[model samples]
Target: AQTVTQSQPEMSVQEAETVTLSCTYDTSESNYYLFWYKQPPSRQMILVIRQEAYKQQNATENRFSVNFQKAAKSFSLKISDSQLGDTAMYFCAFIDFGNEKLTFGTGTRLTIIP
Candidate 1:
Protein backbone atom coordinates (compact mmCIF):
# COMPACT_ATOMS: atom_id res chain seq x y z
CA ALA A 1 0.00 0.00 0.00
CA GLN A 2 1.10 3.52 -0.74
CA THR A 3 0.58 6.60 1.39
CA VAL A 4 0.87 10.26 0.42
CA THR A 5 1.72 13.05 2.81
CA GLN A 6 1.31 16.79 2.27
CA SER A 7 3.24 18.51 5.01
CA GLN A 8 1.71 21.88 4.40
CA PRO A 9 -1.91 22.19 5.38
CA GLU A 10 -2.29 25.73 4.08
CA MET A 11 -0.41 28.02 1.76
CA SER A 12 -0.88 31.50 0.34
CA VAL A 13 0.80 33.14 -2.62
CA GLN A 14 0.43 36.40 -4.45
CA GLU A 15 -1.22 36.45 -7.83
CA ALA A 16 1.08 36.15 -10.82
CA GLU A 17 3.77 34.70 -8.55
CA THR A 18 5.11 31.21 -8.23
CA VAL A 19 4.39 28.71 -5.48
CA THR A 20 5.40 25.17 -4.76
CA LEU A 21 3.40 22.72 -2.64
CA SER A 22 5.32 19.82 -1.21
CA CYS A 23 4.30 16.17 -1.12
CA THR A 24 5.92 12.89 -0.20
CA TYR A 25 4.91 9.27 -0.45
CA ASP A 26 5.82 5.79 0.75
CA THR A 27 5.26 2.69 -1.29
CA SER A 28 6.64 -0.79 -1.56
CA GLU A 29 5.74 -1.01 -5.22
CA SER A 30 8.45 0.05 -7.62
CA ASN A 31 6.25 1.05 -10.52
CA TYR A 32 3.39 3.48 -10.02
CA TYR A 33 1.86 6.81 -10.90
CA LEU A 34 2.07 9.97 -8.83
CA PHE A 35 -0.46 12.73 -9.27
CA TRP A 36 -1.31 16.25 -8.16
CA TYR A 37 -5.01 16.94 -8.12
CA LYS A 38 -6.63 20.32 -7.76
CA GLN A 39 -9.98 21.01 -6.17
CA PRO A 40 -11.25 24.49 -6.73
CA PRO A 41 -13.85 26.25 -4.57
CA SER A 42 -16.34 24.74 -6.94
CA ARG A 43 -15.34 21.42 -5.35
CA GLN A 44 -14.42 19.57 -8.51
CA MET A 45 -11.20 17.62 -8.36
CA ILE A 46 -9.13 18.16 -11.49
CA LEU A 47 -5.97 16.48 -12.60
CA VAL A 48 -3.17 18.99 -12.39
CA ILE A 49 -0.35 16.69 -13.44
CA ARG A 50 1.01 13.18 -13.16
CA GLN A 51 4.40 11.46 -12.95
CA GLU A 52 5.35 7.89 -13.59
CA ALA A 53 7.60 6.35 -10.95
CA TYR A 54 9.67 4.59 -13.59
CA LYS A 55 10.30 7.78 -15.56
CA GLN A 56 13.20 10.04 -14.78
CA GLN A 57 11.63 13.17 -16.18
CA ASN A 58 9.18 15.17 -14.10
CA ALA A 59 5.66 15.63 -15.41
CA THR A 60 4.29 19.03 -16.27
CA GLU A 61 1.05 20.54 -17.53
CA ASN A 62 0.94 24.07 -18.83
CA ARG A 63 1.44 26.38 -15.84
CA PHE A 64 1.67 23.38 -13.52
CA SER A 65 4.77 21.24 -13.07
CA VAL A 66 6.12 18.61 -10.74
CA ASN A 67 9.52 18.00 -9.24
CA PHE A 68 9.64 14.25 -8.89
CA GLN A 69 12.44 12.67 -6.88
CA LYS A 70 11.78 8.98 -7.16
CA ALA A 71 14.45 7.77 -4.78
CA ALA A 72 13.38 10.33 -2.20
CA LYS A 73 9.70 9.62 -2.82
CA SER A 74 8.91 13.26 -3.25
CA PHE A 75 6.52 14.67 -5.83
CA SER A 76 5.98 18.33 -5.26
CA LEU A 77 3.86 20.57 -7.47
CA LYS A 78 5.09 23.90 -8.76
CA ILE A 79 2.66 26.48 -10.06
CA SER A 80 4.08 29.28 -12.09
CA ASP A 81 2.22 32.57 -12.54
CA SER A 82 -0.23 31.70 -9.85
CA GLN A 83 -3.72 33.03 -10.39
CA LEU A 84 -6.93 33.48 -8.42
CA GLY A 85 -8.34 30.57 -10.35
CA ASP A 86 -5.62 28.49 -8.81
CA THR A 87 -7.03 28.89 -5.32
CA ALA A 88 -8.05 25.47 -4.19
CA MET A 89 -7.29 22.38 -2.21
CA TYR A 90 -4.46 20.42 -3.73
CA PHE A 91 -4.07 16.71 -3.11
CA CYS A 92 -1.24 14.35 -3.84
CA ALA A 93 -2.14 10.88 -4.96
CA PHE A 94 -0.41 7.61 -5.78
CA ILE A 95 -1.51 4.58 -7.75
CA ASP A 96 0.31 1.31 -8.02
CA PHE A 97 0.72 -0.27 -11.44
CA GLY A 98 -2.39 -2.23 -12.50
CA ASN A 99 -4.00 -1.81 -9.09
CA GLU A 100 -6.00 1.28 -10.11
CA LYS A 101 -6.45 2.18 -6.44
CA LEU A 102 -5.35 5.67 -5.50
CA THR A 103 -3.91 6.65 -2.14
CA PHE A 104 -4.31 10.36 -1.42
CA GLY A 105 -2.78 12.87 0.95
CA THR A 106 -4.75 15.04 3.33
CA GLY A 107 -4.32 17.98 0.95
CA THR A 108 -3.06 21.55 1.16
CA ARG A 109 -5.40 24.49 0.84
CA LEU A 110 -3.86 27.20 -1.34
CA THR A 111 -5.10 30.75 -1.54
CA ILE A 112 -4.06 33.15 -4.28
CA ILE A 113 -3.78 36.57 -2.73
CA PRO A 114 -4.55 39.40 -5.08
Candidate 2:
Protein backbone atom coordinates (compact mmCIF):
# COMPACT_ATOMS: atom_id res chain seq x y z
CA ALA A 1 0.00 0.00 0.00
CA GLN A 2 1.21 3.50 -0.82
CA THR A 3 0.73 6.14 1.82
CA VAL A 4 1.69 9.82 1.83
CA THR A 5 2.68 11.59 5.02
CA GLN A 6 2.58 15.34 5.44
CA SER A 7 4.47 16.18 8.58
CA GLN A 8 3.44 19.81 8.69
CA PRO A 9 -0.16 20.35 9.70
CA GLU A 10 0.00 24.08 9.02
CA MET A 11 2.47 26.54 7.51
CA SER A 12 2.48 30.32 7.15
CA VAL A 13 4.57 32.38 4.78
CA GLN A 14 4.83 36.08 4.19
CA GLU A 15 3.80 37.41 0.85
CA ALA A 16 6.63 37.48 -1.70
CA GLU A 17 8.59 35.01 0.44
CA THR A 18 9.21 31.31 -0.09
CA VAL A 19 8.03 28.25 1.77
CA THR A 20 8.54 24.52 1.44
CA LEU A 21 6.08 21.90 2.64
CA SER A 22 7.48 18.50 3.41
CA CYS A 23 5.91 15.20 2.27
CA THR A 24 7.01 11.60 2.38
CA TYR A 25 5.53 8.40 1.09
CA ASP A 26 5.95 4.67 1.26
CA THR A 27 5.46 2.78 -1.93
CA SER A 28 6.79 -0.50 -3.20
CA GLU A 29 5.78 0.09 -6.77
CA SER A 30 8.43 1.44 -9.07
CA ASN A 31 6.14 3.00 -11.61
CA TYR A 32 3.86 5.65 -10.16
CA TYR A 33 3.02 9.35 -10.25
CA LEU A 34 3.13 12.01 -7.57
CA PHE A 35 1.06 15.16 -7.46
CA TRP A 36 0.44 18.24 -5.35
CA TYR A 37 -3.09 19.56 -5.29
CA LYS A 38 -4.21 22.80 -3.72
CA GLN A 39 -7.73 23.38 -2.43
CA PRO A 40 -8.72 26.93 -1.65
CA PRO A 41 -11.73 27.98 0.41
CA SER A 42 -13.84 27.18 -2.63
CA ARG A 43 -12.85 23.52 -2.15
CA GLN A 44 -11.79 22.96 -5.69
CA MET A 45 -8.75 20.80 -6.30
CA ILE A 46 -6.04 22.45 -8.38
CA LEU A 47 -3.02 20.67 -9.67
CA VAL A 48 0.06 22.47 -8.45
CA ILE A 49 2.77 20.17 -9.84
CA ARG A 50 3.39 16.60 -10.87
CA GLN A 51 6.41 14.32 -11.01
CA GLU A 52 6.66 10.92 -12.61
CA ALA A 53 8.65 8.38 -10.68
CA TYR A 54 10.72 7.41 -13.69
CA LYS A 55 11.78 11.00 -14.30
CA GLN A 56 14.97 12.10 -12.65
CA GLN A 57 14.51 15.85 -12.90
CA ASN A 58 12.07 17.69 -10.71
CA ALA A 59 8.96 19.40 -12.09
CA THR A 60 8.29 23.11 -12.02
CA GLU A 61 5.22 25.20 -12.75
CA ASN A 62 5.43 28.96 -12.55
CA ARG A 63 6.25 29.74 -8.91
CA PHE A 64 5.68 26.17 -7.80
CA SER A 65 8.32 23.44 -7.86
CA VAL A 66 8.86 20.01 -6.45
CA ASN A 67 11.78 18.27 -4.82
CA PHE A 68 11.22 14.68 -5.86
CA GLN A 69 13.50 12.13 -4.22
CA LYS A 70 12.39 8.81 -5.62
CA ALA A 71 14.95 6.84 -3.68
CA ALA A 72 13.83 8.32 -0.38
CA LYS A 73 10.17 8.26 -1.31
CA SER A 74 9.98 11.94 -0.49
CA PHE A 75 8.24 14.58 -2.57
CA SER A 76 8.00 18.15 -1.28
CA LEU A 77 6.40 21.27 -2.70
CA LYS A 78 8.22 24.61 -2.75
CA ILE A 79 6.32 27.79 -3.32
CA SER A 80 8.50 30.70 -4.33
CA ASP A 81 7.45 34.31 -4.01
CA SER A 82 4.34 33.25 -2.23
CA GLN A 83 1.20 35.28 -2.70
CA LEU A 84 -1.99 35.80 -0.74
CA GLY A 85 -3.78 33.85 -3.42
CA ASP A 86 -1.68 30.81 -2.57
CA THR A 87 -3.35 30.40 0.78
CA ALA A 88 -4.99 26.99 0.77
CA MET A 89 -4.73 23.38 1.82
CA TYR A 90 -2.02 21.53 -0.05
CA PHE A 91 -2.33 17.80 -0.45
CA CYS A 92 0.23 15.31 -1.68
CA ALA A 93 -1.08 12.44 -3.75
CA PHE A 94 0.24 9.32 -5.40
CA ILE A 95 -1.32 7.25 -8.13
CA ASP A 96 -0.17 3.77 -8.85
CA PHE A 97 -0.36 2.48 -12.38
CA GLY A 98 -2.21 -0.57 -11.14
CA ASN A 99 -4.85 1.53 -9.48
CA GLU A 100 -6.36 4.66 -10.92
CA LYS A 101 -7.41 5.98 -7.54
CA LEU A 102 -5.26 8.61 -5.87
CA THR A 103 -3.89 8.20 -2.38
CA PHE A 104 -3.67 11.56 -0.64
CA GLY A 105 -1.97 12.83 2.45
CA THR A 106 -3.64 14.49 5.38
CA GLY A 107 -2.79 17.87 3.84
CA THR A 108 -0.97 20.97 5.04
CA ARG A 109 -2.94 24.16 5.41
CA LEU A 110 -0.88 27.05 4.05
CA THR A 111 -1.59 30.66 4.95
CA ILE A 112 0.12 33.44 3.07
CA ILE A 113 0.38 36.43 5.37
CA PRO A 114 0.35 39.79 3.74
Give me the candidate number with maximum lDDT.
2
lDDT of 1 at 34: 91
Q: Estimate each model's TM-score.
A: 0.97, 0.98
Candidate 1 accuracy as lDDT: 0.93
TM-score of 2: 0.98
Candidate 2, RMSD to the unseen true structure: 0.5
Q: lDDT of each model, Cα atoms only?
A: 0.93, 0.96
Candidate 1 per-residue lDDT, tens place, 59-112, comes to 888999999998899999999999999999999999998797889999999999
